[model samples]
Target: MKKIFAILMTVSITYFASSQSKTFPIASTLTTIDGETINSNTFKHDGPIIIDFWATYCKPCIIKYNTLKDKYAEWQKRTGVKIISISIDPASRVESAKKFVEAFEWPYEMYFDLDSELISKLNNGSKVVPLTLIYDKDFNLVHKSTGASVLYEGSAKKGVKHLYSGKKEITDFTVDLSKYFEIIDQIISK
Candidate 1:
């Protein structure tokens, strides 16, 4: 009994220490919007990188992309961070997805995960749209959120409020990009 207890304690400590130092898997291969294959490691730089998982048909995802498109340049300049937007749309919708991306004129790197390879690697099995993952300069997974609203203050609750409002529902939603920038600031400062 004493020997068994000692072995269990050793395993527990090893597991805890490993879990505490989790890093992002930057070796996964993902395709660019231009159909060029590339590895996620290409995004790693001297600063943090934000990977946004989205779908073409997802309304909230569209809102988040639009908001990010407007502020991407400023955010890049200020924080030296890069945002990689990955589309998890079906293969049949690849053309449509390209059209949508072109319409928005997003100045960030865009990729299509038709087989969900990268998404599966990042999300760990659960598939959800508008998922954002932030990785530090060393490729460590720093922050992750399921929805765009979570990136900003009160945006999620505000969307819920509009849904329950006794008036024509507002379809337009926006997030405070400054909040996201603040996150980059915090991660890079560390």
Candidate 2:
């Protein structure tokens, strides 16, 4: 009987921990394109937030950013959503990353994670580029994708295409922002 009781207690505790939502590591230190230091927690938006982790040399990451940029304005105006593009480039490539951002004229909030501290915290130390985390207004991490994902319409069914471990070519792939907006809407409505 004692063993059974102990097992039950352990199960209960594990369930409780697993069921809890995780918040962003706002305390993590990150740098801006201008080399200014700031705590990540300072980023707050009126609604849901999207954080994309990318590097200057990551092709898939670049494709995702460009695709998202096409519909970013509409997404923001409709949902008040904020997208933060965080470059995980090393210190040596910081200048290049800045140049890339400038050359593209990306309007989203941009930051630099030189040491990947924020990425490690959010992705359990996985060094995968093009990872995206979606958070609700309360900063609870609601959805995370490790690779490129896009919604597609085929055969009368909508589908999601996912590529992982940087193995897929994203030259022709485009993420469906509508699906992301649907997810945001669900989270915000809850």
lDDT of each residue in 97-149, candidate 1, tens digit only: 99988887877778888788777877888779888888887777888888655
Q: Against the unseen true structure, what C-alpha lDDT does each candidate score?
A: 0.75, 0.78
How many residue pairs clash in model 1? 0
The C-alpha TM-scores of every prediction are 0.74, 0.73
Find the candidate with the highest lDDT and give its number: 2
lDDT of 2: 0.78
What CA RMSD would you report for each candidate? 9.9, 10.6
Task: Report the Cα lDDT for residue 139, model 1.
Answer: 75
Worst 10 residues of 2 by lDDT: 151-160
For every model shown, the clashing-pair count is 0, 0
